[model samples]
Target chain A: MSTGAVIEFTSISKRFGGVAAVKDLSFTVEPGRVTGFLGPNGAGKTTSLRILLGLVAASSGTATFGGVRYRDLPHPLKTVGAALEAASFHPGRTARDHLGVYAIAAGLPRTRVMEVLTLVGLAAHAAQRVGGYSLGMRQRLGLAYALLGDPGVLVLDEPINGLDPEGIRWIRGFLRDMAAEGRTVLVSSHLLSEVQQSVDDVVIIARGELVHLGPLSSLDTDAAPQTIVESPDREALAAALTAAGITFSIGRTGLLAATGDPALLGHLAFTAGVELSVLHRQKAGLEDSFLALVGGGHTL
Target chain B: MTMFLRSVSAEFAKIFTTRLWWILAIVLFGYIGLLAGGLAALFAGIQTGVISPDAVNTGGGPTDFGSLPPLIYSFASSVGYVFPVLLGALATTGEFRHQTLTPTFLATPRRGLVLGAKTVTLVLIGAGFGVVALAASVGIGGGVLSAFGVDALLQGAETWLLVARTLLAMGLWAAIGVGLGALVPNQVASIVIVLAFTQFVEPLLRLAASFLEVTAKIGNFLPGAASDALVGASVFTMASPAGTAPLDWWQGGLVLLGYALIATVIGYAVSWKRDVT
Candidate 1:
């Protein structure tokens, strides 16, 4: 298998008429890892992917696979495989016929079509027309098309949207396995939760601008961790937290402390002679942090 | 060169895999066969004195028995040309309708090459449609003419020349369809334009232009007229005043080609290069 190349988007922007669809977006996806491109609806994720694949012209800046633009690549399909969000098959064509068209156009062997069909678990349905395919089967067929050339880099948009839970689970492992083979995998979804477990790193965008780009774990670090603390002496606990210069807010369950370390709060409470019934570290959920980073107004 | 050949092959595959091509060809066959056979029988009946010209009221009827064979053969291009045009337009518009251009561009990054391959493929398929159409017109129409005691003239070189020219005309019509479809990627809009222009707009314009000497000269340049001129005969053109002459065959071919080229170039510049998504 060919190893993945770095996918780089440098200061890319696209405007349709006067409306800016993508604005000064820049990021790089490294090889041997799955990168989740998370964004809200109409956040220009599809446009960015399209630009990277040379389907859309960027208003300014460049997107390249490794060091070369997608259009300039001599063997584009061999180097990179892309399935856009709106990429669709002709309903009249059978799955095999659909892949066969690309395979022939790209000069790939006919056997590759069957190989990829089996890879995506669509071997049995290869003879069936796409008009009869369910959404999940269509998604698999798209993946099969992406794998036809056994490309080093795979780019899929909203790959898990209509999958059953089992299908979603299968894809998560499939993505990881592809990355494990040293291929760069960039999967996009509007909901972070959809890809939270599958992705090692994330490139989050909202309203056409990059909000965050780093390891998935790093996103949590930016969010200030809190501790949920409570006691029978609620008033005394509040007074103790105030005297200790630690910020605290009352919640339905307890006083929400500004400290991440529960032990520190416990020690402070002990020193203040406040009997604490509860003192636990509250880890910020990645979903909450994702919404906060992008502003909580839009639905994921 | 190999890549281009593969692209063309892929385009051919794209068309054959769908039922639309054969469906349209069958329709063309049936439609042209019935009309050509019916007309050949009626005209041959009059020429042979079996049916009175007065009863038909064809204005003393066709006096040129020699022109009948070529005229009937030309029906493949003159009347049945729309099938190939519709086929070609649908091929391009279907890509846009199904959003298949995404994968197409992904496989072949050079947009120009894809368009070129489509043009070449559609031209060939259009010629194939021409063959089916001619099979009907020449086979059924010739049989009818022979049965009515009018010479079928199937063995004549002129008749074969008309057949070849009809094939060429249909291929060019297909190219024009591709150009129009590329120029208007919307399926419904492209189809509407094709039907409206071919069935209503151009025919009316051609009829209206034939009334005036100055306009008649210009009318010969219209796609349908040029196609008829290329085929060397047309039932519709037989109604026009004899003073309004058709252009030479090669000139007619060039005029048809010019229409295809202009539409393709403008479409390439305006829409083909635009963002597909």
Candidate 2:
């Protein structure tokens, strides 16, 4: 797979009513890789995609696809295929006709409609109207629409929302393959852990602002292999770490301690003769990193 | 050009193929024909003679189309005006109702182009309905007229002109509907307003025009008044027993055109300014 089209957002900002939904955000999505936009609800993940697609007017910043404004693009469908949040189907139009109209509009052949339908596993219901579709089916149809143009870039918003486990697995592999083909893919989801397992890179937002932006590897930076220790001398271990200035968060299960090195923590414990009931380096999961980035939009 | 035409063809297919649109079309044609039949029955009882033979222009119609029968032209104008309005509203409001516009807008990205294609579709559909409606009205109403030994004026230049006039008036009405559809973008609201003006309000205004001296004059510029000019023998809004100036067919046509242009511009303005989602 080739790394394909490049998109850049320069100081993009958008507001609704009195609230700023996206604030002075700047990021780049390069070709040939999957970039995950991770945040909790209302973190402005969907807003950014809308702006990129020219669906929403940006208040202060510009989002460009391949250095061109979305409106200026000669063939928008062939350039960027987006399924942003809403599964906007003409409920009365059959699936084939729904895709067929877009194909005609995009100047693509009719056969491509069947191809996409088959690809998305909507072939059996191709004659069915969208109103009867399940949430998962609607999502597949949305993806079919996005792929109709064979676009160089794919922008999806919370694609896994109502998908079952198998469906989610299929999408993850499909996205990976598309990115492998060198197409630029941006997938946004409120579930960071799910994205972390599925994405190579990420842009984290919190309360309408950028909190973290980097590879999934970055989530592991503050990560440690963790074990729940219920030692009678738990107080002693906790005191030792505190005196050593090791910062630890006390979770419901146990005193969550962070260690610079697991070997050192073990050596220290062995020397101190602290009986080990449970001890291990804490593993940093994408879920924790995501929760830390966006402390829940409304409460924050 | 091919791309534009292709999109237009697809649009036509969508509008023509949908059950709602077809139902609306059947309603429009049947309702107008039914109203004409009712009028034919009422007028047959009252006089059994064609009241309009001399050409009169009230709103937007071509004077040269020769003098058309009063009921024939009136029914055409009244119904024609409504076709475009419903078409316009249906074209845009359907998108809003079905939420298909997102994928549409996404595929096009050029909002202006999509809007342009829809405008073209509106005109095409309007003109088509105009011609078809004239045939239906004339064929049905004219036959009823001939049975009363009043077939003398059915042939000649006046007859042809009336057909052309019906076409023009109906096309304009449809365009106005398109504008309302775009601006409202809601099916229920669009239908309510369109139905209200065409049915209840105009009839009430026509009934009151005879008694109210000033309202009689204002009623001429109303939709029904404008329609009466094209449909009736003389343009002074003969539909209602109100005092109105006889606008030449050209003048009446211009008034309808003006209303259509204003509505279309406003529709585009709203669509352009609103967020795409």
Superposed on all Cα atoms, the candidates' RMSDs to the truth, in angstroms, are 2.3, 5.5
Interface RMSD of 1: 0.8
Q: How many backbone clashes does candidate 2 have?
A: 34
Task: Give one clash count per candidate, in the order shown.
Answer: 0, 34
Global local distance difference test of model 1: 0.90
| Cα lDDT for residue A183, candidate 2 | 94
Model 1 agreement with the true structure over B105-139: per-residue lDDT tens digits: 99999999999999999999999999999999999
Task: Give the candidate number with the greatest lDDT.
Answer: 1
Report the lDDT tens digits of candidate 1 across residue range A121-190: 9999999999999989999999888888889999999999888999999999999999999999999998
* Candidate with best TM-score: 1
Isolated chain B TM-score per model:
0.97, 0.80
Could you give candidate 2's fraction of true interface contacts? 0.70
- For model 2, the DockQ equals 0.53
Candidate 2 per-residue lDDT, tens place, B73-163, comes to: 4565665466667777777788878777778777676666676677777777777777656655666666665565545266677777767
